[model samples]
Target: MTAASPPSASRPRYAVYVVLVLMVAYMLSFMDRVLISLMIDPIRTELGLGDTQVGLLVGFGFVLLYSIMGIPFGAIADSGNRRNLMVGGVLGWSAATAVSGFAGGFISLLAARAMVGIGEATLSPAAYSTIADRFEKRKLGFAVSLYNMGVSLGGGVAMLFGGVLVAWAMATAVPLPWGELTGWRLAFVAVGLLGVPLAAVMLLTVREAPRRQGGIKPPPLSALWALAMRHKAAFAAVVIGYSILVIAAYGAMLWAPVHFARAHGMSPAHLGLAFGVIIGLFGTVGLAIGGLLSDRSAKRGHPDAPVRIVLASAVLQFPLMMGAYLASDTTVALVLAAAGMATVSTIGGLQAGTLQILTPASMRGRMTAIYLLVANMAGMGLGPLVTGFVSEHLFDGPTSLGKALALVTAVSLTIGVALLLLARKAIIAAVLDNDRAEAEAG
Candidate 1:
């Protein structure tokens, strides 16, 4: 059998279009995912709930299914039509979000959130795999960074838009669409509805690149397992380090508004605006800078450039997170919060680029699924829950929440720094081995 031609030498300009489409999808995914945070207070008041219950809704409730289904979704992304999977996932999550608006009680809302998780589980693996196939290695870091901007942007939209919606409802005394539906539920519906348009765009325009252009079958689960086992340290380090970071990130994301509102006595509108602007603007800038630096470092022959950047960022993050928690002034706290977010977010692109470099094309999705399982299981599953538990039980009051969050975030950052430093050598080795293999094969 003849060797299949390497995907045409001329890179497809439409690759940018594909990236844009995926980013839009990711934006909607995160917006739907995060809107609940903005609505937390109103929901708790309306439902007669506690912080623990709210944490469960945003944490394990969403993450349980999202993490479990992520692996199979990743595997399917490897072998199936990626664009279709993304479109379907977007639609699924969108409908789920809409249903959340109609939820009458705690259990119904939890079910809707869980369904959202199941649908979102399909997006990243497929998007990442598709980008890996489409972009050359050199440009991968920046490309991934650009895509990750969706997270920051989506998060900003969730808060800013949700805040505005809540303000409008409160100001107008407009009876919520449903008699019982008020703050958080309304936020959910508005954010969820935005996905419909994005889903339509994805389905109509985005085309899946051919899988395994060289006639290779997608790697079997055993092969993926063996690869992870063989590269045990690198695999574990990436997964664990990122997961730890995510715990801090998600916990902070869930609690920042609450912390600010209570600690600084800020209004929801002001808190949402502050968090949204800081996270959106600085987060985007930081991600772009990290991607650029990583790409430049790789070109200069440091395959571990992205990993090193992550390590440095984690180091800076320790103090920044602590500062955010400890600061008395709202402005000071917001500044520190922005710095912490920017520092931690720098790793967003680096992780994606590193995974793509280390894994072969056929196994990229499976490996990504493994990474997602570990990352989400630890990060999304436990981060907010642990923080909420600590704030409510260990610390036992609103006043202690900031200090508790600061302490945990500092510890997580420290652990992340250590793991990233350890993984540096392994990442370099993997990249070199991949480079050598490709050179020989060529």
Candidate 2:
């Protein structure tokens, strides 16, 4: 087999532009995805719903469709115009978000949330494939990490801004121009509206990189299926492990403000700002550090870097999460929570980069879709819901909410660690094989 040609030695300045655009798009994606958490109380009260319903709206309602649609969207991304897909996705989610402001009941809100998911489903696989196409393998980790910064920044922005927005809306006590829209509705509208201009910018500014040169064009569908079968173990582990981790992460994020408010008697605005700062700063730092470290380790021939990092993160996370759960002092709990966020976020870049390395360029989108389907279904879909269920049923009151969330997080991390450890050997072998193949092909 002919070797794949080495990518350009000097990275282009345009790459920075691409990264910026992708990051913004990611930010918007997450903001739309997560802002609902901050608005949960207001929406729940307005809709006369319980925590279980709120959990379903935030978790299963959004993630089920998002996860399910990601695959076909990913497949389409591989062969279609990535720029168009991304722009269209942005528009769809943005519109959905705006409509969420107008939601009169639970069903309308659920529909809006599902629409947001459908739009978001198009982003990751396409974005990952585009990034891989643009950057060399060596730089891919950092580039991907930069894009993943959206996860951290978006969460932070959602929490921080959601709080401020909700607080402002509550204070204003003004009638909506359209009708009797509340603060939560206005927040959704404002956040959703921001996506329109960004979509236009992405359309104008981001160009899809040329596909890798010189490889025989394998049929896309067959290629994806073959790749999945070939790396079944790694793919399965990544999907499951990632899903579990996300469940814990999103669960913590969705309910932490409410937990803090009830347990510690803090205001929503204060809780939002605090959580946002922690997630934004520490989470971003952790992701960057992890990606850089993983890339360095991989270059030095440590094929297990991804798994090792994830394993270490999972192990460290359990105690920190437990501390956050059990600590009586708000300050101490916040500190521990920050540490936990940092540790867990390290997996983002490592997982994305690993998948890129293991799969062919053509199948990157579909593989990512598959990974996301499981990850979101389990992680995003169940994380918040499980925590809510346990808090409501098993724990039986606000006092036990922290313990319930903490226990669920711990259990998920424990399971994740075991799976990651078992997958370590397979990840190493896959990395070695990929490197060997790339070297021979080049």
Candidate 3:
């Protein structure tokens, strides 16, 4: 059930092509996912929604269907055509986003967002599994980091694009082929259309990578359960620890622009340009740093490099992240926020690469499914929702958002650090033991 190393050799040129495709795919999904953040105010105004409703639309609604559907999709990725799955996901989510443009009320918008979740649910598991098949383990951290840059790229682009639209819409409705629409609605429709060509590119250009199972039978629920039981500490560290951390990370991310807008009296266009550059430049740099550090440390006899990097990043991030929320000066907050985001962004790809090291090839997709279920559901789902609830209901309404953000972030980061520490010794032991066993077998 252990992972088998392929014959060691230089990586092929096509591997680069594959990573590019997956990275763009990752970017496309994020653009669709985050375009709403810039338009939250307009969406609320048009839909007659409150903060809680916004929380449901952006946070829980997407993660609910995404987490539920990911399990079966994960299994299919293990045994089916992952490239096709990616194509279907792109098409489905793209169409759903277009539909979101036309939604008359909260219920309809929520439904459309749910389908977006379902489509996106197919991506990470399938993409990661395919990457594992194509790249050698040594280079994998870098490859994954490159792919994960989509978060920054996609998010940055969305903010920038939505900001332009927002400024324009404030002046006049965007002229569509049929008629006209508000900036927020038009944002949804515009992002949705982008996926059509991407889906076609995926189908025509990218070929499926072979599975790395070494003749292992198709993974079943029993196998997945057994895998979880076998690596409880590591899984707990990654799943629970990271999820807790994401409460801080993703919540801060979702609300950051609003903080700038409400507290600092900034425009959407300004927030977009600032954050887009920060995310595009700094976030990408951080991902590269994490990957290089991980690979180099592993080469220097630290098999637990990925987790180690994440743990260190967590400690360094808390102060910077909290400072972003608490700082009085807008410029100071943005500077601190950029630093915070770099550290926050470092963990995603490296952690996924680390888990691949831990899991058997046969179970990578399902294991990822489980990881995403807990991580996305608990992290992305509750982080923003709880932040909003505390801000709106528990604290002073709306004005207390920064304070609410700091409290949530501070608590979650602390717990996350503790969990990662718990995971460390277990991970080191597992890696050394596996290496020894593999050596003997060879």
Candidate 4:
């Protein structure tokens, strides 16, 4: 047999640059996604809407299309020029965001939000697949974790700076070529337009990874389906476990600002600053710890290191979430929320890294798409909606936000922990099987 080829000597600087771009892209996607959370009250008061409708706008509108489109986009990323795909995607979502500024009512705004979801869907599969190829196995966790930091950074910026922007827009009512748009509307347009230039930069600088399955076209959906079926238990565990985790995470994320406003009577700017620190700073630390722990565990020959770390996070998350929602004092609630954000921050990067490790490079995009489809639809799509439903229907008052949030977290996270633990054996088996296959191929 021929010897394996020597590794590429690509400069480490290039990889760092690439990760930074993707992280920013991820941050922008999230800023667009979560900005609505901060504007919930303004939109509701202006439109004569209720919690349920706001929840739909925040949850289902974007997620339905995002979840549905992710599969095909993932397939595209698997075979196409990922950089080009991202360029179009960024422009599309950004334009949609601007269009949201012009929305006359709930339906039009929802339409624009859905469009944003579709565009944002193109990002993760391609970014994840590219990062997996750029970095090697041992360092994969750290690199992916670093990339995932966008979740916190973007979220932080959205609340911290988004609050400032909204307040300024509200106070100044700044004139523009489009007329004096309202503060919330101005935000949608401004943030949306920000992506257009960034897309151009990515188009100019980012390059596609060398496809691991070069010369072999990406397999069709049926073939991908078969591969997934072959590892049914592990996929089930991953999809279900993460889905459950996100239900709690997204529910809280989308509503936490609203909760603070109602419970503590905080200003939008204050709420933004509070959550910005909670999620942004605490989350950054969590991702770092999780990534270091996972990478070290893998280097030490632990096959299930990623999942194990996620499980540990889940364990800590249960209490943090419970305490945050249940705490009567505003300061106590924020403190608990910060601790909780740190733990959940680990979920995205570690889980993404684990999925990349288990899947062949050829199938990473599609697998990621499938993973996002299930995870987003369940976690992101329904999480906020259900929380709102409970708030509007069960509790029947704005003050019930805390109870609604707690219910979702307790039920969902308990189940998530159980599912992840069960997936451990399957994850290990897949790692061993993949290693054996690669050794034989070499």
Candidate 2 lDDT over 1-442, as tens digits, reads: 1235324224567876787788889988888666777777778888998878888898889999998999889877777778889899999989998998888899989998999999989989888988887777877788888888899888888887878888876666447576665588878888888998998898887777666643445355776666557877776777787677776777666777678777877777887788788778888898898888877876787767666776777788788878887788999999998998888678766777778888777678888888888878877777878878888888765557787788888888878777777887777777677778667645
Per-residue alpha-carbon lDDT of candidate 4 for residues 209-245, written as tens digits (9 for 90 to 100): 6655565667677876776688777878887888888
TM-score (all chains, Cα) for each model: 0.95, 0.95, 0.94, 0.96
Q: What is the C-alpha RMSD of each candidate to the true structure, in Å?
A: 2.3, 2.2, 2.4, 1.9
Choose the strongest candidate by TM-score: 4
lDDT, candidate 1, 369-395, per-residue tens? 888888887777787777888888887
* Candidate with best lDDT: 4
Which ranking of candidates, highest lDDT first?
Answer: 4, 3, 1, 2
Candidate 3 lDDT: 0.82
The CA lDDT of each predicted structure is 0.80, 0.79, 0.82, 0.85
Q: Is candidate 2 or candidate 4 better by lDDT?
A: 4
Backbone clash pairs for candidate 3 read: none
Q: Which residue pairs of candidate 2 clash?
A: 2-441, 3-441, 3-442, 4-441, 4-442, 247-379
Candidate 3: worst 10 consecutive residues by lDDT?
1-10
Q: Report the error of model 2 at residue 154, Å.
A: 0.8
- Stretches > 4 Å off in candidate 2: 1-11, 173-178, 213-218
